[model samples]
Structures are given as C-alpha cells and as structure tokens.
Target: MGVRFSKFPLCWWPSSIKSNLHDMSDIDDGNKNEKDHLPGFTEYSLDQLRSTTSGFSPDNIVSEHGEKAPNVVYKGVLEDDRWIAVKRFNKSAWPDSRQFLEEARAVGQLRNERLANLIGCCCEGEERLLVAEFMPNETLSKHLFHWETQPMKWAMRLRVALYLAQALDFCSSKGRALYHDLNAYRILFDQDGNPRLSCFGLMKNSRDGASYSTNLAFTPPEYLRTGRITPESVIYSFGTLLLDLLSGKHIPPSHALDLIRSKNFLPLIDSCLEGHFSNDDGTELVRLASRCLQYEPRERPNAKSLVTALTPLQKETWVPSYVLMGIPDGSASSNQSLSLTPFGEACFRRDFTAIHEILEKLGYKDDEDVANELSFQMWTNQIQETLTSKKHGDSAFRAKDFSTAIDRYTQFIDAGTMVSPTVYARRCFCYLMNQMPQEALGDAMQAQSVSPTWPTAFYLQAAALFSLGMDNDAQESLKDGTTLETRENRN
Candidate 1:
C-alpha cells in the first residue's frame, strides 16, 4: 500500500519519485472525478489555468544551480508579468506518461498558508514541467547553508522550524499520505525571506489523499522496517530537520541523528545564530524529534501534538525576513510570521513576573476609563497561559486537569472577549474543583455583570454564594433565576 519498500542493508526511500519510488503508481488523469473531490473544494487541470511557458531553450533558462546535483531551473513570465520557476525533468527517465500529470495534480491541489503554492504542470507529451510561484530568495537551504550569507538568528531559525513542521502537517492531512521526504534541499526561501517548503512531487498520498512517502533513512526504526507511512516517520524527519536547522547541513546518510545523541552534531549547528540558542529547549525539541524518529512508528507525536509543542515558541520575537515572504507548502500559510515587540521579547526571556505586574496594573479600576478592551483580553490570555503551564502557581489545582472550565470564564473577562452565562456556569464547577471559591464567585459575578438579564448567571451566582456561606445573598440572587439548564446544573 506504500512505496516499493525493501530492507536489505537498512531500508530507504528510492532515489527518485518518478523512477524508483513505487506504490505511487502511474495515476491516470481521470482520478480527478466526482468522488475524488476534496471536502468543499474542486479540482482543476492546466487547461483551466491562464497559460504556461514552454522552453528547454537557452533564452528562457534563468539559472542553473548545483548543490547535491545540477538542477536546471527555467524562468517563465506569467500573465501577471510574474516570473515563475519551472523545473523540466527528463521525461525519458520517468517510468510513466501520466506520472507528471499526477505529480502536478497532487502539488497543485494543496493550498497552504506557509508553503510555496504549486501552480500547475504542463504534460507536453514526454516532457513534464512543474510550474510554481516565482520565489526570489530561492531555497532556505541556500542562505542557511551558504558561505556568503549571514548566519540565521535563533528566532528566525525557530520560525522556519515551525513553518516546515506545519507545512508537512498540511501535506500529511491533505492527500491522506505521509511526506516520506523532508530534506533541506526541498525547502526554498522566498524573496520576502520566509522559507517555502517545496518538492511535493515525491509526496505520498494516503487513503484520504493527504500523506507523503516515508524517507527510510529518516524513518523511525519502527517504521523503517515497515511499509506503513505513519506520523512517526514524519517525526523522524522532523528530528532530522532540527539537525538540519541547527547545523545548516543536509540530513546525514543515516536515520535518527540527534544533537544530544552525538556531541559532534550539537556543534554542527549554524554558527551564524551567534551560538544563541536554547540548549535546554533545543535539546527537548531534539529529544522529541528523536522520539518521532524512533525505531517504531508508534512512539512518534502527531502533527497536532507537534503544533502544541511549538506554539509557545510562536509567541516569541523572531527577526523579520530581511525582504522575503514565506510561502505555503501543503500545510502552512503563504505567510507565517512574528513580531519583534519589546513585550514579546520580555516574554521570550521568561520575565513572567514583570508581565504579570503589567497585567495587574492594566486591570486597575478606573471610573474615568471607558472599558479598556484590548488590555483586558491581553491580561486574560496571559493569565490563561500561566494557568496552563506547570510552572504557574495555579496549575497545581487540577482535579484531574479540569482547567478548561475556569479558562472559558477567565476568557470572558478579556477586553473584547464575551461568553454566555451558560459557559460561566460550566467554568464555576472547575473553580470549585480547585477550591477556588472566591474566583468562582468572581466568574459568576462577571457573568451576571455581562448580562444581568440572563437568569442562569444568577443561579450560578446563587450556587457559588451558598458555597461561600452567603446563604441570604444566594436566596436573593435566586429571585431572578429561571433557565431550566441553569437551575438543574445549579441544583
């Protein structure tokens, strides 16, 4: 069901998707049919596109580059006067006539927020051309690994890491296939300086049509031995990606190379980052990547979990792409970015106490102040993030981790945030679990304050009040209660 897999002297992905790669059989153009359409989306062919440029001619060729090997890239002018990249591979080398069409279809169908979009492909008899959005900066590999370019800063490197993982995630979910290939050579940095993941021609489609092939060398030991394409394989690749990011080098000939596993690899990281990187965080990320690259696919974290792990890093300050913009591959957006704000920098430095103090100051009661919505939401989000982290003073109160109950209510206090009384009543139980009677009472009161006409908040308030031994106030508040759900929940 997966690529043509074999384990002789350790398993590995075949050299070319067009040649050695199997199971990605010669798919016919007719596969694009009524049943094949993605959810709420339509499919298209090159004919539907405005037009395409044709040339093996010297005039149309913009530049020829060689890193691993010589790649002939052509320059074409679109109707919009935009110059695009077209890599015309030798068709004779390909195994099938329809393979190019399928590759085009697979790459073109993906619409990512963080990857370079595949425009279309021209199946000119034997020749196959993959047309793509013209990226000015070329590949991230060029700058990051190049001798002339400045070293990639720590934050910038992290942003690219997030973008790449998200791109792979998008590809994995879209075609129902695993991205078996995630080498640095495939990731191109655009003119706006954002890394755009490319090389989906080798992407493997799963049952749902959104997966990539497993790079055997990068494949976890568990999956390297199997023909299955699991997220763990991607995780293995992610670990390799981390190695690539830190070292600004290609993934080694072997699978599962970690910065921690080999001290030699740790020093291989990009020297341009001023050696300014988190050994702790990088080590954790490396270990996580290593887990994904485990001998078994079952040990790896899924893309969603990867997203959660990388979410905190997203909030930190990263250098803006000098003049480049990132493009979406299959999973990311055309533009994944961050700010260099002072407060953002402080958060990155883990100055939580300073941030907490700022929030407290902003929360001050000002009779003259017309509800500071932005400030309120900022403080609330901060509080929620704090409560979620283990280091936070409040996370110790989990009655089997029921923080979401209070989170929703706390969210309501944010400047622009608003929640119905029903939601507050739900969170009150969470506060009660944490033995936070005062906080529960506050949530209940805020719910009532937001909508005094809502009867449920009063019922919730009554329950909280009674718990606090304010029986008389609870009875008085109950006078306005009427909603059946609230009353039942309260009782």
Candidate 2:
C-alpha cells in the first residue's frame, strides 16, 4: 500500500486550520471574480477542471509513480482542447485549503520559458488541484534511463543542465528558491520539445508532514537531519541530477564523489555518450558536480555560478533546444510553404547586402515616392481606425499586456491598410512574449517583405527562427541584421 497519513477529525485541528477551512468558501468566491492578472496562471473552477480530466478517471492519471498517492497527477485536455496536467492533492496532503491556494498562487506567478508554466489552480472545499501546461514528451528520467529508443546525446544532456540551472535561477530570483523535490522526473518536455522544469516542484511542503520519494541517501544532509530544505540543498540535488545525466543511472552522491576523486569518471559516464564528448568537457562537468555535491550546503556554488560554468562547456550555442532533443525540425516544412517574392527570397536567404544592391539597382533607395506609395494607399477613415487600433496595441505592448496587444494588433492587421514595418515587428515581439513563435515568425517575415532594409525586421526574424529551432538560419539572419544596422549607421 502507498504511504498513508493518520486521519484527523475536523474538531481536533487547530483553530487557525479550522478558520482557514471555513474561509475557503469566501476565498473561492473572490478568486472566481478576480481576473487571472498573473501571466501563465489561472484559477479553474472545479467543474471546469473535472470536465478537463474526465472526472479524474484512472486512465487520465499520468504519474509514473501511481495515482493512489496523496498527490496524484492527471493529464487532461482543457475545454479549448489545450493539453494540461492536473495535480490533485488528496485531503490528507493539504488540510488547509487556503495554504494550498497561497502556495499554488505563489508558484503560478513565476513565469519563465524554462519552467512548465502553471495554467491555474482549483480550491473548493476539500478539493485542491494545480493545472499546468502538459508536456507531450515524458519526463527526463524516461529519456535518461530505461530507454526504449536511442540514448540522449551528450550535447542535449549538457543543454538540459543549463536549462535546469537557468530555471532554478529564475525561481530564485522570484523568491521561490526552495524546490520541494528536484530530480530527473521534475524535468519535462513541452510541445516544442524543449525541456522545462515542472513548476509543481516549487510548492512548499505541507505543515502536516515532510515528503520525499527518494531514498534518504539521495536527499540533502540537512533535510535528513533537520527535516527542512534550504536553497543550498537544491544545489546538492542539482548535483545528483548532473550525476544522473553523466552516469545514466542514479548513483549516490558520496560514491559519485569518490569516483570523481579517483579520476575514474569514464566508467561512471553513460556508455551511450561515448565519443560524443571530450575528456576536458567530462572533467569540467565532474568538477562542477563535485562542487554541488559538497557535504556542507554553504560550500556549493549558486545557480548563477553553475550557469556561468556550464555556458563555456556548451560546444554548440547555435543549436536550438528542440534540435538537441532530436525533435524533427518543423520550421523546414513551414519555410517551404512561404511563397517568396524576389525580395522575400533574398530575405529568406538572409542576404541583406544582396537585397540592398537589388533595391538600388531597381532605383528604390529610400525614395520618397516609394515610401509615399506604400504609406498612403488607404482611405482616411480606414487609416484613422488602423492608427487608433495600433496606438492601443502599442500601448498594451509597452505595458507587457501581450494578450491585449495581440488582439489589438490582429484588429489592425485585419483592417487591410498599409502600415509601417515597425508595427509588424512590434506585433511579432508581442507574439514572442505570448509564446507564439510561429505567429511571430510570420509577422517577422511580413515585416521584412514590407521593408527589406529594416534591420529590426531581420533581428526579429532571427529571434523567431531561434525560438522555432532553426538556429543556423537565426544566426545568419542576426548577422544580416548587424550588417544592415552597421551600414545604415555608416551612411
């Protein structure tokens, strides 16, 4: 049987706990009325959540560990058909509904590309659930161990370390530094096939009891002694993760340190990664891992330091995370569908200099007539409406209201009036902020088509391309933008 906690009657609980439970009705009503101002977070009604998970059916449970546990996770599809993972906390896990909401809200507010963004939460009486963006790809554990397919590549492993460290850094920055459990299972892959740390790990331990699935040997020393976790303890766990990546198996930190001391890391390394990494690369990683595994919490380096150390060790910064994960490049087929005019063709190849030469040959060098012709083709009323919408969009964009910006920009674009490349570029940036990379790339392309010489267009294109896992193309586009910017400045 799964671990079980002793049941307690409501009368036996503390006054504060009882008060918290009594206030749940008010809290639920307030949350329902308030808009989810927090980006990447939502507050789902219990009915909405139930519909998503088909009443939390047994088949919906995706936790490899099992569903009978206090904290059970179910994979669900939202009403809009967006995939999500709903984590349901049993009554034994969180008796205080308010505490659960507070903790869930705190974690939900943390927004980072490296994190599996929290969609929302549900707190109604005894039911407490956390809804997070679903990851189609399984956890890092499945990929690292018990592999049915090819083993993870060395470069991908290195990238995962950097991503996880960056994720931790973001959480630390937001004052949610204490991760409940940091392990391979905590890393998940998104639709784009990029690895993201599960935000559920950010939830603090319950007042009722401490919880840890791994053996005590794998846990931090402080947690074993004091039953409390600190930020530094996270670093120690990160070290264990690094060891898992290197060895392809769970090895005790003490034993891993011993192997590192003997300079016998080759045996510890995953044989699948043989010949993929150099001796120096392996040595540097082992050294970093050793620092993280320090018995004393204060001895371990911070996440920022880990990022700095790992940055140089990354041999291919231009390779996108999806590519590193062996995901098939979707951008290639998308690129094929784009019907490129001559100028668009040049932009596609990232040939800014060639584009400039062609434009000059065509006698279109910043010509007033060309600008006027492009800028003045619409009726005054339509122009005024477009401008009004654009003004609102720009205001929203500047304020970081990406959803509002997207809606307003869509209105402006659909108005069918000619606008400046800057408008398209701005909308593209908003798309990027909203995690709509494909739409961002589309807008970037439109910007380039409208104004081929615009440096910002190429720059936005590069960013969009990089996000879509077309890194080589992104680099070329970035170079083109730099060249265009430098030339314009020189003139």
List lDDT for all candidates, in order: 0.50, 0.73
Q: Note each model's CA RMSD in angstroms.
A: 19.3, 17.7
TM-score of each: 0.49, 0.65
For candidate 1, give the lDDT of residue 289.
58
For candidate 2, the lDDT comes to 0.73
The whole-model C-alpha lDDT of candidate 1 against the native structure comes to 0.50
Which tens-of-lDDT digit does each residue in 241-326 have in candidate 1?
Answer: 77777667666525335434664544655566554766666666665556655555676677767767776765233224542233
Looking at model 2, the pairs that clash are 42-119, 42-120
Off by over 4 Å in 1: 1-54, 58-71, 93-95, 202-231, 251-259, 262-268, 315-319, 323-491
Write candidate 2's Cα lDDT for 209-319 as tens digits.
Answer: 565678888999888999888999999999999999998999999888888888888767989888889988888889999999998999999999999999888766656
Error of 2 at 264 (Å): 2.3
- How large an RMSD does model 1 have? 19.3
Choose the strongest candidate by lDDT: 2
